[model samples]
Target: MRIGLDIGGTKIDAVAVAPTGQTVDRVRVPTGFGAEQVVANTLQVIDALRGRTGTTPTAVGIGIPGLIDHETGWVRHAVNLGLSEVALGPLVAEHVGLPVQVENDVNVAALGAAQAMHLDGAHAYLNIGTGLAAGIVVDRRLWRGARGNAGEVGHIPVLADGPPCVCGQRGCLETVASGSALAAAWPGHPGTTATEVFDSADAGDPAATAVRDRFVAGVASAVRILVVTVDVDSVVIGGGLAALGERLLLPLRADFDEAARSSPFVASLGLSSRVLLAPLDQPLAALGAAHLAPESAVTTA
Candidate 1:
């Protein structure tokens, strides 16, 4: 068995995956800063899950947000968690006494989504949740580009004079199209999540509807770039926002179709039905990490 920990801004998801591709048991705890406390929470979850599985985990994997250098076990910046230049993987390994690998959470989720598939072809995973990002899976391996910053698709600057991004860029895809933007425009709702905004738009709230339409354009534009760049067969959507289903998807599909309809470069791409909703609601990182543990690294004694 293997252990996977997905640390996010709001929650920490831990799971124990058996060898046969099953999530046998799961645990979750709210997330916080105080880096030491965050690591402690993960250890506690792992300790609690250790008993039932009957074997020491072959490996441990953690998924965190922000820019990470997986090779050096360094997290250059993780703003939501208030960490900068933290040696995250080594610290967690010290506490847990296991081989641990740390990676950008969205990338892990992408791997997990890909892992859930048949694995005979290339695919992409797009997560639009509290934020927007992607993970690329080609030929059954993650395309971690040079410097491990391959999938910073959210900051890819789709607009020239767009709104300001947390990354300090203007007109970035995440600024105008993500859950944060929808929540900013409509603040008083019961559920300020992305789903609620779409629900409000579905119910005819003008402000919500405006953001919804803009969001579709933005998402379709982003997906088009991904399709053209990566040439993947399909893109899977996961995370909190995806719970809204076709209420969000239909419009996105329409936009992608409209955008790709006339491009000769994208003509033979066959991307009309390329976008797909993830079968699993939880983000993919933790599971992908756990699944990767033993095989990704080998010991020499």
Candidate 2:
């Protein structure tokens, strides 16, 4: 068995997966603030899964939200988790006595989503959740850029005068498109979550509808940016807002279709067909993490 963990902004998801990709056991715990609590909470979840499985995992893989030095397994920064320069892989390896491989969460999720969809060649995983970002795969391999921040498209400037981003920039796409942005901009209610905004829009609230429309447009723009830039096979949408299902995809599809009808260049790209929603039930990031370490790293322990 192998242990896979996805350390997300809100929750840390861990799973024990058999060789056949079947889940042996899974556990989730709320993500803790600060580096120490995050590591402690992650270990607690791992131990719980190990107890349930009654065996030490052959290898362990972790997906964290930040710029990870893949060679050292040190996280340069994970803003949402309040972590910086934390040696997460070494810490987890010492605690579990297992070989550990840590990667950026979205990059691992890209692999997971590709595996789940049985995709090959090139694909882009567009995650519009707590923040907006993407993970790219080329020829079945992760295209981590020179700085291991290849897919940090969230900070891409979409508006000249957009809201501020934690990355010390204004007009970032995340400022307008992310779940955090949606919650902050909800017209009908204060502290309304992205999911709640979708709910209210579904109920025909005009104010909520306006926000939803703009959000969808922003999402469409993200899709266009990915396709025009990379021309990947498909752009798979995953993350917290993905739970809204067709409520999200349908509008996005309509927008793309309209764009295609207006511009032959858009139609020629067939961008709408390439945009897809990720499966709801799949724990892709964790599953991808399970396969991250090579076979040589698996220990008898």
What TM-score quantifies how close candidate 2 is to the native fold? 0.87
Off by over 4 Å in 2: 54-56, 187-191, 199-206, 293-301
What digit string (tens of lDDT, one per residue) describes model 1 on residues 1-301? 8888888887788888887878888888877785776767777778877876667877788888888777656788888887788877777677667777777887788778877765547777878876788887776567887766665678888889987888899888887667786676567653555766677788999987887898877777667778777777888876667776787688987766665577765656655688888876554787877755354432221
The lowest-lDDT stretch of 10 consecutive residues in candidate 2 is: 292-301
lDDT of 1 at 146: 75
Local accuracy of candidate 2 as per-residue lDDT tens digits, 1-301: 9888999888999889898877788899999999989999988998999999998787888898877877667788998899999988888888888888888898889988887888898898999887899999876567877877776778888889788887889988887778877977874454447768888888999988888988998888888888888878899999878887798899999999998898999999898789999998988999878767454232223
How accurate locally is residue 289 in candidate 1, as Cα lDDT from 0 to 100? 71
Model 1 regions lying over 4 Å from their true place: 187-193, 205-207, 260-267, 293-301
In lDDT terms, how accurate is model 2? 0.84
What value of lDDT does candidate 1 attain over all alpha carbons? Answer: 0.75
